[model samples]
Target: MKLTLIFLIMISFLSGCNKSENDEKPEKKELELKSKEVLEATDRFGWELLQAVNKEADPGQNVVISSLSVAQALGMTTNGAANETLSQMLDVMDFGEVSEMNEAFHNIREVLQTADPKVQVDIANSVWYRQGMPAKESFGEALEEDYDAAFREVDFSKKQEAKDLINGWVNDKTKGKIPSIVDEISAGQYMFLINAVYFLGKWQYEFDKSATKDEDFTLSDGSTMQVPMMNQETDLDFYSGEDCQAVKLPYGDGSFYMVIALPANGIELDEFINSLDTNKWSTITDNMHERGLALFMPRFEVECKFKLNQTLIDMGMELPFSEFGADFSNMTEAQVFIDEVMHKTYIKADEEGTEAAAVTSVSVVVTSVGGGGPMPFRIDRPFFFAIAEEESDAILFSGKIENPKQ
Candidate 1:
């Protein structure tokens, strides 16, 4: 009952995902430090995810890697790196003392610790069904007012107090990186999960806008589109040989970078992604050198939302949301457990740093990257991407591009 009271209190101040764009911006590597705890937590999670991608992905598109790190999330000028930390954590239903998973939960709380107490309560967030279902019933009267319905009522004309209060708080923290906190919610949702993000960044060397060109981009399906590609010839960490096709673009001070792994011709994209290993990731990072190279980036931003219930089931970690659940007895007794889990994330970028965050929740119901390789993978078309921090290579966001339409 005490645990229920605490969680229910959190659910009141919840904020659902305000999905944003994937707009790309110009940024260069620079020197920025991160909390050591955040670094270890992020990398360990990223490593675990690499292990999963190495096993489960399809032949052509099996392993996709991308990230947004704490540094990048908190940055003002450069994207953190390919973001992968959160995606892996979402797939796992139980932590089971695994160092990475444990560290991950710790890092999340660490970030939360920095937030204002009112901010935490105002979000009224948690993972569970809210309609007095068997799960939400634990809270008695504390758990009323569905966050989803509240989101629906937030019209530009007449906004709900809950939504406005939370969004304003997030905007202030992120320096406007996250302008809107609640995009949409439903009456049937069991839990109201909210994640706030903040970021600021600048390019080491600003792009000469005059050099931007409307170039042809060959997508995976052999289709082509005209995109404004930011092209620059600079000294970069480049590697090319029989085993790989790749390059690393540094932002600002050379402490962080964006690495692209291109698949070799004739090899299936999914196969290359699925066959990924830590060494392959290592090679991309290890072989990187400061050399003269050409950089081409399309000016584009994409925002998407997806129901990932099926995707999580496909992964190996499947115990908590089920009748066989995570043991949260430490929080309270009375056989309390998670019911359902949901996750929502958003990212946006351009000539500079990336601003992104992921939010996930588990109820009486439930809840829950990248790189490289031999024969060189060319991501000229649809491919996996990540945003990572340098020291720990903490990935904050991760996703696949099988059919962006969905």
Candidate 2:
């Protein structure tokens, strides 16, 4: 008989934009071979994850998520998986091999953290296990060496103390943008693998605060509400697609950007989102060109929380969550499986730029779980947006704003 080990993993990501002046742009560097491959793979995975989550969301509801955070946390956990569990995770994430994935993630983290001196990007990882639980030495070593993860052995029986330790790290890493992720620790839960990312950068071109004014924002329901819309007329990387108008707003030193896409007048936000795929996304992003134009977007904030177990199962990653069939023996001597995945996100976009944060927590009782365009480009209606790195085009955060006020 296999002894079941319950594991919980929490992944959190945070990004902030403040007003600043940095006239110099960072020099573009060529991506290494492994970095390039992983970027493409993760980008594909990110899109698929976004579409899946959107499908599960309520009609007209807002959604924001950090694909990088989810990938990092799961990537660390993948080190412990074997057999079909490993294969399914690799297939779902679009990764080629384990060694390649590990090396690539390490390289990408290095590149992203030092991408621009003007921008601040921090990535952190941790491993927490029950005080006496036996875990594979190789598993912990890989996480520490490849992902720079910090390890702590805690008394799981002391639930409140363990919870505080984990949540405190999250709060500190996110600069208090997200106060806590683990609400309570269950009895069967033994270990947690976590990843936290924090990013802060200013816009290359800040919107004038004086120009922001009350404007009508059209909701998905066709109702309209007054919102503080920021207006700007400047040169920006713009794309005119058959389905939507898109623009890329660069952040500090041009190493990062926020891409916003507004579906054509008659198209619904959901319809446009459903039509998006990796192929279309690449083509649209590749075609963007700098152009001078009038731009209007509301200064708004959105917070979203979701339980993503069924979503991942629907996406063809079911074995790891299974109680009987799950194989995480590579991680520990005991049989373990995932239990739940919880994701929460917050974003605020204004004239200064955009500030966003997300936390994706996977609880393994062992179970678990688990963009646009432009125009003179008025975003008066519901639209999609993403924060990404310019070099690899890796999406750090992505979401839709149905109504900014909500």
Candidate 3:
């Protein structure tokens, strides 16, 4: 199937602060579209987030974005004929020059293969590769798995089995740090179609046992709760906003960042969440000027699973995957339509904190750390977080921490 991530340049104004925005369209709008479908997938949730997965902020910058699609990728190849929705999506995917990178492609294959002797990955995008032929060959070889229907079309009706398969792959890929994949899937017309899954996580310098302690969590809507808070008193880039305050905690060798959001008092939980917008996100990102600040957050983790069917319906994207309105003929012999799309994610943070996992279909990878902080923002009630590349502002991971110890 085809996948797209179109991160268009969007602009908005925060409530109080009229943040200056860069509306000047980039001279080079070199965006690849099939990926756009994948990027807009998050429109279902205002608070939901998907960002870039850049290497650390140190010297040699490396990036890794992993995506597992279970739909059109297999829809057009298998099934009564793979799903056309996914097939048409992939029609324009550019493989670029990655087909040339033999060594690098081999290494990628080794990593994925060494990781899963059972499951195989197939990459078919016409995307460009900058590292010349070696890198191209690496990608090509890494994606050289023929269709056998094992990891091909997913049996959505067999939900548990579906979860098991994806969880297995994600668990292996994340080195057990995260398990962000479901076992099965189902499309109305087809009992078994394709699916896409992804998982990513990083340890920002393992938390010291002595640093965690019980603390108070003040949520919006005037509610206060007690929760374990992770205390790491280090200098960092901090923002104290009128609507909501935020703290950027560096993570892993400095490639990505973990940004925590604590809403202002008197703000209702639903109200605050409802108020979420690109402008709010933009405000937080633009205010990311590195500043010396201390930080502390409740040591808590949460596991949340959401059936995004209705959520997607609520978003403006009800056109492609709708029951009566979907148009996916390019993928299969049948008029393939999107039956439903589901999502489940989990995260835990405590004294020896911050452990989380999620399951979904898409691409992204991030782990950054090259800054400072000692910020204290308990997330007892509800707060937002994101895994992002500090340099480019591309967010790879984003979620809300409602219950700290849950």
Candidate 4:
């Protein structure tokens, strides 16, 4: 099995939105890439969100998440929002306007989906609503054309079947890596919008598994555990920061790479994570240059699951989840609000390559907050990692490994 990680975010909104887009598919048009300003904004949003959700991590526990999945799902949710609800969501997401963010998301997806032939990056979006829910025409049109999302009518009252069908779609999109995203559909959840991204890539320079050996991985509390260590020494883009060290490991054609950042000894991982910003991130990756250094990393896996309603609220997106204060009139004529947002991610890294997937589900009834250098980069303790596209600088998946043994 290749080093693989899967991330899933399930957002459950309480209110339902628009109807099916017309059956006929429109002629394809070449989409433009996101502007530098918007792309930078998107990157900043990811980092800020990383800080927000990092608050939920437990001491000495691993946490990994997909910022792309969260942004895509919430961006889709913004389409049907209006008034204060829309404003707050946009502010929290750091998006200027719904139209611009929609385009940015489309462009980013387009670039990533077609980045390289050797690497497989697929992003799929869909909407499933209870049969007879009267979602608005404008809302449906936006979702169809702007987001390129498929629409399905389901009997949400038949909770079990509805849950299974939605979960099956996510499983299929993630290549069966994520079998199910929804275990239960609550009483008032009239609709669900889901986005899934699956990525598979081979290391530009593969590690020799034959040289792998068990080594000691130190924990934050000074405890240690034995883990399979993979060793490689090549001229890789490396950077050293005031508080951390980082390196970029290219994948496939080098359009995409995994950047890992390890905190300097004596710097707490949480302290470093809290202080990270776009400037700090840029300072590290921008200063990176090809340097020959010994790289020793543990081969490990991480699975993180979270309910993001509170995290988002903490990030200044409180109105959407407020059952009484939300305004989703653009989606439906009735009173509606978001309820909850759920996220789950899984990742595994070894010698050959890396494979990862993420799913973001938004239920209308309710919800949803929601990188590095290299140096001798011995990631013996807690550290962070991000997989991103070089051109757009869009972060696809990111996480912190506190203790891989768990």
Candidate maximizing lDDT: 2
Q: How many steric overlaps does candidate 1 have?
A: 103
- What is the number of residue pairs that collide in model 2? 21
Q: What is the lDDT of candidate 1?
A: 0.40
Backbone clashes for every candidate come to: 103, 21, 103, 32
Order the numbered candidates by lDDT, best leading.
2, 4, 1, 3
Candidate 2's C-alpha lDDT?
Answer: 0.80
lDDT by candidate, in order shown: 0.40, 0.80, 0.40, 0.78
Query: Predicted candidate 4: what Cα RMSD to the true structure?
Result: 9.2
Query: Can you tell me which runs of candidate 4 are displaced by over 4 Å?
Result: 1-35, 366-376
Tens digits of per-residue lDDT, candidate 3, 207-285, equal 5667667777754335677776655554566677887888776554454557777778776444454565556777876
Model 2, 179-204: lDDT tens per residue? 88888788778677777777787889
When 1 and 4 are scored with TM-score, the better candidate is 4
Pitting candidate 2 against candidate 4, the one with the higher TM-score is 2
Predicted candidate 4 versus true structure: per-residue lDDT over 1-406, tens digit per residue: 0011111111112223342332121212233544455667767777887777888777777777788888888888888889999999988777787888877776676667666656788888888876888678898888777677888889988888888889989999888877777877877776788888888998898889998888989888888989888988778898886798898999988988999998887888888888877888788889998878779988877767777888889889998888778888888766667776777677778898888888877766733311334346577887888998887777888878887768
Question: In model 4, what is the error at residue 255, expressed in angstroms?
Answer: 0.5
TM-score of each: 0.57, 0.89, 0.56, 0.88
Candidate 3 clashes: the total is 103
The runs of at least 3 residues in candidate 1 whose Cα sits more than 4 Å from the true structure, single-residue gaps closed, are 1-199, 241-243, 323-327, 332-340, 361-380, 399-406
